[model samples]
Target chain A: MEKNNNHDRFFRELLSDSSREMPFSDFEDEVMAEIRMEYEKKFSGRRNIRLSWLFFILGMLSGIATVFVMSFYSANQPFAFISDNLLPVGIVFICLTIILFAEKLVKISFRRDNH
Target chain B: MDELYIKKVLDGDIDAFRYFVHQYKDKAYNLAFSVLKNEFDARDAVQEAYIIAFRKLGKFRGRSKFSTWFFRIVINEALKSSKKAGKEKYIADTRTESVDPGHVEINDIVSRDQQKYYIDLAMQNIPSKEALALTLFYIEEYSVEEIREITGWTESNTKVLLHRARKSMYHELNVLLSTEKKTLY
Candidate 1:
């Protein structure tokens, strides 16, 4: 139809017209900043993981060394001594629990922050 | 040109990736805008797409032009954002009428400026896929093969989409302009 032709001509003209440039200045800087920040965040996460693993290994070794030293000192009755000092033993157990949970808490917080 | 930046990026130079982003920002924004019809969403989509492309750079494999690979990412992000924003409702409503230019009524002396406005408005209403294809074709002057690459559609599918888009845009513009005239006069 004539109307269709008219409309097609109009569309052709509209499309043929040059589009205005996107109104963004310093977009590259913003994106670069974001990418940089992302890398830093990733690097920090990996560093934290390594640190956590190192701390874990160190804690396990210290625990083993404390047991060895305690057994050597109380070779005659290590179990009886430990039972006799339930308060100190309980405190040590609590501290270990706190440390383990604190590490887990930090990991959870990091995951939350990233997401 | 972009391949050089991509290579540099692959070599662990993060800053070099900026060159590719700077080069394609405008075209990417335009393509996103063509689908989203919202400036802020389009901008966000481009940014997110670029970040995704940067992270996924290792998988690029150089099988296609960097531009094509980048464009596919941008268009996919824009579509996801568009869907999330519920703009697809407008597109669906506008796509109802099969382009029947015979139904249009155009006065002989319509202004170019007016036509341009209606054209833009109509563009916002068409199906997102068609609008995206037409945008790439007209604004970027991309070849059909390039559009096919960008859209991940077959060559025949891309051509058919463009044809449908052209017809749909023509009819939508006529209808929109006629409605505007009725309201104005």
Candidate 2:
């Protein structure tokens, strides 16, 4: 048992002494550069998604407001046509929103799984 | 301290990751070298590991030390490179060659000032897995449980690997020293 302990201690000393530092002086810089590129790539992807959602929400809000205004001002000849088609327009808008939302959700889940 | 850096990195301070790189680089390189046994391959493995750790930094839940998680990445990256290079066969072949002190080459032993060179050469003769176990247990001073955690190996498996590693290291060092003595005479 003592002999085994001695051997272990000896090996430990030798191994510890043999421990080496990374020889590359710029190793940290190289790794950090790669990491920075990856970070930018990931964040840029997220930013693009956010921007797309912003545009989609803005477009949806404007479409709804236009429909609401036209329905209220139905007495005008130009909006009378819109007022008659308001139900179909609302349904189409709702469907589009749902489809876009579902698409975004699927994309997000796929991204999460990939990561 | 590591937590602080992790938080900084998570907060989008990309430069904060440099702290981890500087801190763990040497040890990670040593571990990589132990597994791959080729300096360039080990370096590439370490770089790839760091890149992976950075990409997955957001997923770090802090259940363990960052070093532990990072070391696991390093080991996995090294193992992957080792597999790709088909160095598993190299390790197995070395394992089958008996350590014959009589056949020890005088040119293989270095002067006292180059003891580390001699030790590294000795390490090259052992199985990579055994070398990795020895490096984690002896050089890094990690406990067997920590090793198991880092390596995802069972406790008994880690213990057995450490035992075999020590035996191989001892025999290899004996052969080296015997060669040195023969040269002296």
Candidate 3:
């Protein structure tokens, strides 16, 4: 038992002596750079989502404004084709907006869950 | 303290992660070296591990100490590197052999100047798992339970590995010293 203890102590001392110092001085910096890159990628993804939403909102508002303005035009006006198809056009626009919004929301929620 | 830094990193404070990198780098390097046995490979493994930890930091549930979790990543990365370099077969072959210690005197053979060199050589000769077990048990002074936690091994398996590791380490040291003795005389 005593011999085993001595051997254990000796091995411990030897192992401690063999413990090495890291050679690379810039190790932390290298790791941090990679981490920063990942952070930037995530930040850019979020920015892209925000930009998409901004464009979507702008497009939706412009569609509504165009329809509203066309409503005041006579049937013989140059935009009569648009006014004649306004209701169906509005329905299709609303459905498409809802689908795009739902897709964006799903993607954001999926990313959040992954993180 | 680690939790605080983890929270800061998760909160998008990228600089806060430097604290962890500085704190664990050396110890993590040593652990990586124990498995890979090459300075450059060990360093690359540790760097990769740190990047992995950072990328996966959000999934950290704080169930274990940050060091334990990080060390596990370091070991896995080192093991993967060793496997890629075709060194895993060499490490695996060393584990099954039992060496007879004979009558070698460790203290008489190892001089102060050569102590670190011979010990490192012996560690390199042993199986990587045994080397890792010895480093965590002796150098790091972690309990068997803690080792089990870090390694995801069962309690009995951890104990058995430690026992075999100690025996293999002593045998390897004896062989190294005996070779040195023959070379000297």
Candidate 4:
């Protein structure tokens, strides 16, 4: 208790205007303005990071379109000559391939909740 | 109203530059003064921060609070100034306050002015990062997380720096005050 009291008293006195000086006035505005200016000077050198978002969206859109086109093509395929005696098996295989690929695509793209 | 004027500047209202200076110049100046400890250096650092902030205002997406973003700029500017000039310290200006031990009542001797001077003196002697952390934490009363965010340091790093700074100040002041009392007796 005594130790804590002394520590508190010490800070109260240390920050006392009698011993320590307030550095300067209106510190926020003056220094912040200067920093703003410096940021401006450096602006021309580097591009902002948000620009990458456009590329990310575009990539996602392209992948989605490709999957849709592939699925549609598979759905329309005639199984007469190719499937022969194993038509049901061939259709099932195609469906399973698309399902597996879709899972893979989503997993590889966003990478969310991998655990 | 000031924020609106600043918005105008961001919108390319060149004349609003005057109000920009009015709004933030002194605040920036004082912060730099506290960090750099040299009046002229502080003045230049603040001026530099203003110019940088003004030029970069357009790119500000308002994701963070304006004051927080502005402080980031001010801190960078101060650090740069310190690096270049190596921090010229202790300007005993007109406001020089020498707290004689006699001023405070005897009952709270530890909290008295003279003891505080010893603490302050110890603080002044530490590395800049430790001093900066102490000031930002205790004087500014910022939370540890806030200090980490503002200083761009990890939470552990902030805690360690603050702990070390406080410990050093404790030891330094204890020795100083003991010697002071010895002389007096």
Best by TM-score: 3
Candidate 3 lDDT at A72 equals 66
As for TM-score, the candidate ahead, 1 or 3, is: 3
Sort by DockQ, best first.
3, 2, 1, 4
Listing candidates in order, what is each one's chain A TM-score?
0.56, 0.55, 0.58, 0.30
Ranking by lDDT: 2, 3, 1, 4
Write model 2 residue lDDT over B89-148, tens digit each, in one string.
343324323443234342355655567777788789888889999899888999989999
Sort all candidates by TM-score, best to worst.
Answer: 3, 2, 1, 4
Give the alpha carbon lDDT tens digit for every residue of A1-115 in model 3: 7766765676676667776778999888898998888778877877877787788778777877766666766355687777677656775777788688869766884674343
Docking class of 2: medium
List runs of model 3 lying over 4 Å from the truth: A1-4, A53-105, A113-115, B91-102
Candidate 2 residue runs with Cα over 4 Å from true position? A51-101, A113-115, B90-110, B174-185
CAPRI tier of model 3: medium
lDDT of 2 by residue, A17-66 (tens): 77879999989989998998888888777777777777767777787786
Give one digit per residue, the lDDT tens place, for model 4 in B29-78. Answer: 54565567566776777677766666677666777666556767877898
Q: Give the TM-score (0 to 1) of chain B in model 1.
A: 0.84
Could you say which candidate leads in DockQ?
Answer: 3
Question: Once superposed on the true structure, which residue ranges of model 1 sit more than 4 Å away at CA?
Answer: A1-13, A18-20, A70-74, A78-115, B90-108, B154-157, B179-185
Candidates 1 and 4 compared by DockQ, better number:
1
- lDDT of residue B7 for candidate 1: 86
Considering chain A alone, report the TM-score of candidate 1 relative to the true chain A: 0.56
